[model samples]
Target: MFILPAALAFYRALRVYPSPVELMMIYQKTVPEPIFKIVIELTNLDVKDRVEGYYNKFPPQSLGVKVETRMVGDISKKALVLTKDVQVGEVIYKEFPIVGALDSDLQPKGLYCTQCLREVEPSMSIKSPESPVYEAVYCSQACQSLAKPQHHNLLFTLERPLPPQIPLDEITPEKLEARRKAHTQFADYLKNQAYGHSAPLLVARFIARQVASEMNKLIPGSSGIPSSQDYAGADDEEYLLADHIERLRYVEITPPQEELKLITAVLDTVLPGLDSLVTEERYSTLLGKMAYNAFGVYYDGARDDKPAPTARPEDIERTRTPMGTSRQIGSAVYTVSSYLAHSCDPNARPSFNAGNSQLHLIANRDLKAGEELTVAYVDVAQRQDESVEECRRRRRMELARGWKFACPCERCEREGTTVGSEDEENIGDESRVEKNMQRFESNEGPL
Candidate 1:
């Protein structure tokens, strides 16, 4: 049976320490321990419940998929399995992003709808003239309306950040000017400093969305804006955005201090204490999660004209895309799609057929009912002038560098042994999970 590591760790900590004072010291040593404890307690109501009812609330059957625990060389991991057989080209599920951001270069060009990431004609675009910091153009009034309430007002425009039900201090010209200044500074930073990586912008928008969701709850009969969960067919009220995000694994990242300060200032300016929602540590984790799980948004296959990234190869941000990040027009994070594991020869693929951020997960091949669903996180096809061995090495290296995981899928294994290649002998999966999560998933007792 799966046991939450958070509970196990807390139990062991109590046994080892055996004193309330000692527990306080333990909490001090691990700053996020208290927060994790709360998350686990709130989510994991019992020993049987996993990740605070994540699996229970988002059951696989609801989406034509089931999550199964499998052993990958003694490492217990979750896999999304098909509940029923599916023919090739059939869509298994559709999902929308929690937050999406257009590419930095494209944001200034106003070539796409900022909300849906859809191409917009210059004459037909709806421009946000009130926003002093950012240039946001929507393809339609509906997109503009949704974007403002969702995150645009809080992040870019000088509108009231919270719902009318939430009491606010008397608004003055000086205060409005301050808020405008903060938004401009944050927007400038994104435009100038946050190129190549969309995580900073994505994280900023996500935090704003969370605040919006919370504020809307204070007002009766106000749904604010439809969230990604609504599109995914999940009950939005049953779970907070935090409940979904905290369960996902994150890469280690140290976001620039200035970036955090800028974002905090923007939040704080709109509503005092709003900045507390994103502490430095929390901000880092959020950025890491965005970096690790974001999918590149593209249309009509993808574009070939994305400007060459000036950052070092190691520093350039990569999103999950079989066509490569260069081809994507934007980046987005999805709750369910995040769980689809990687494979060099994947049986499924993500499609944006509507020419927007909504993702349609389609089966790549005829899939059995119990077969695991997989998608290529990186481009895995053999390029012209490249040998099969070369292609394998290239994809493996990309996975290792981008995701910090070595491909151990059947295709990689079969090709590795057949080609007698040993170039990647030193490469191994270096990806990590939160300590408590790792312990729980591994079924290991606490230290």
Candidate 2:
């Protein structure tokens, strides 16, 4: 390991003239380990550990970039800021993760590789005869193998009869009961949180898998996943779910009983003679968490030869199932990407790569060290005139209704003056609203 004196001097030289060569020189002189391995360790450590390690190794002034938590008004905002200037179009980070949800209604069956969420060539897809859900779709043998664990637990076909269809005008008691029963069974199976029937269930499974993976690392020669009987007693198993779900943004209002009842009915229907596998409270929490955190999965470009759909263009917006494209094929929660805070004017942008099931975060402009990276939760570029008040109104509506936080961003502070310090207001300027009818557009910034 490098000593403090060596590290400090190396850091100072790099600060004065930062380059790949300088970095390599410092590493060669001080680090006995492979430089690439050290770089990977630095990049992949837990955010807190990474920040602390960097600060300890070199003065904060020496590192040109850092990810830090800072107080913004009463809230703590986690931002990825530059310690040095970075050029526009530079990729800040990249992640490849399986999507939690894909709209089967929009995408043709077998369009995506199950494991990586990458698009599959129809001719290259593998088929499963035994499974109903995944019976005829997979991008490759490798993806199928990679997805086997999650699939085995969550993707079994139920040996049950489908309820007979009844015409809408001739509704009957028997039909209603059958429909209810079918839905209940679906809910029960869904509660297992296996392959992400819903975003929340998928998120739950993601959390569980991560916990199990970590546990395996700590305990050798044994599966890290504890049996249900041992789950409660296991260390931090429950907290993993609690912590991740809590990160979702939601309004502080209580869910209605009707919704709760609907969820309870489904749990009851799953496995008739057995006890319900999911509790109503847990189900409710999953629903709440999903409401705020799920990301739309879409083909990055047009999916076919058809003319663009009537909806807004993809280049300027995040549209699910955009006009000519396959649109949103599904939804996902990229755990790390969720940390980015919303900004009307942002310094970073997220672009999906359908080919590899990856999310790429690109610099929107030349960013100075210490400038926080941000992305607009809603379309910031869609608004033509850039009326400050219109932006405030739209942001307030989204925050109050969905995000459950009062934004104190510079733009919000500027336009929210007459609307009261804390309360959000509706934007009544129809003409201004009409100018920016699209949602989630990213064209306005310096990308």
Candidate 3:
């Protein structure tokens, strides 16, 4: 039996990091209470306190945090408040940490760990046994196993070849209309029977799965559930109806009429005339729900601006900032994440981690105890570099175009200035940032 002082001294002498498993072994073997205390102190944790804290904040298997409603001007808005103070770079929340598998022949090859989205060596990759679209690569077998349960179905579907790439230049009105007709037929097929899976639709399917999972949790005896949309099951039918009504009440807004047309188009393909199955009002409301809450999902190695010119591709691939350095892969609606409202100058930012297919809300700056956490819908990182008028105009235009809201951000309110360009402004000018995003997305493909 080693003395407490001797054990502590031995622990201090070891320069290498110790795994938690090793620490547990040492903890169990330590005879003296003082040596156990030393181990606890070294780990920087009070297990009892941590266990209590977690149970106090959340129910068993429940996600933590609460949504609060507050009045901004005359409108009541929802915001996600932190249950505890988090330090800088600490993740407040993480959701959908994994996404659809990346296509093989994707550029910046083997950039991310298939499991954790951590950068992995190309030499370290292990291929999925028989996957076609995904040459699934992971940091380790453990990661591959962790991803298998949630990702297996999608992976099997990707065993077929991906459709041919569409050129960005060929997105003309005529071409779009033709594709729309073909897509409508495809949607009908999807409605009647499951055949093919597209990346964007896969994201929607993922959201439906999440919604169904949440619904199952809320209901009794819903174990071993298969699928949930309207008419999937009696329990699911009730949940879907109640969920939409609840969403409307939570957001406190009516569905925008303009978005209904897009909804109609989507429903035509996915549900194949299911648009007429539901009431027009109900269908429109669902579209509005999606429009208001959906977030753009991005994956690792999507950003071109992140890597240093001399940085190796592997080094560049590791960058996973909350606001993302790359183009978006797809969009999905989250029940809890949707509570975060938009701010031009945000205190928090959302980062999509593809490893776990989760979105993490990170602190952009030090936050007070009760600060309503806000995230920017538009990238406002360049505000400091640009003029106030330029910032205001850009934000206003973005808000109008993307969010369907006028600029009411603190910066816009404070600046109260606008400038217009006399010449026709080409928004698509091939700037360095634009070029980088295009190159990265074109090479890697969307999430």
Q: Give the number of the best model, judged by lDDT.
A: 1
Return the clash pairs for model 1, or none.
43-52, 44-52
Quote model 1's TM-score.
Answer: 0.84
lDDT of 2 at 59: 19
Give one digit per residue, the lDDT tens place, for model 3 in 1-447: 445544443233211111234434544564366766665575464333432342133211233355555665544544567666667787776654223333212212566654444556777776665443334567787766544433332223221111122112334465444435544443343333221112233333333333323323322333313321212112232222223222321111243353344334533333233233334444433444444455655655454432223433222211112343234433444545666777777778777654333567788887666777888776565556787667667655554433345545787677764334511232333133234323432332111
User: Which segments of model 1 are wrong by more than 4 Å?
Assistant: 1-52, 193-195, 221-224, 228-230, 233-235, 417-437, 440-447
lDDT of each: 0.75, 0.44, 0.43
Tens digits of per-residue lDDT, candidate 1, 341-440, equal 9999999999999899999999998998989899999999989989887888888877766776767888888777464343345243353433333564
What is the C-alpha lDDT profile of model 2 across 1-447, one tens digit per residue?
Answer: 334433332322222111224345445655554544545344344334422443223212332444466666433445556667778998766654423544433233576765556777778778655454323366776656444433222223232211122111343565445445644444354444322235433533453343223323332233333322211111232223233333333322244454445444432332221113233454454554454455555455624432343543211212211121234455555545555666766778767753544666678898877788777665544367657666667555554444445555777765565865336232333223223321111121100
Best by TM-score: 1
- Residue 296, candidate 3: Cα error in Å is 3.1
Candidate with better TM-score, 1 vs 3: 1
Show where candidate 2 strays beyond 4 Å.
Answer: 1-67, 81-85, 133-136, 155-201, 207-278, 302-327, 354-356, 383-392, 414-447
Model 2: lDDT of residue 25 = 49
The true-versus-predicted C-alpha distance at residue 407 of model 3, in Å, is 3.2
lDDT of 1 at 109: 90
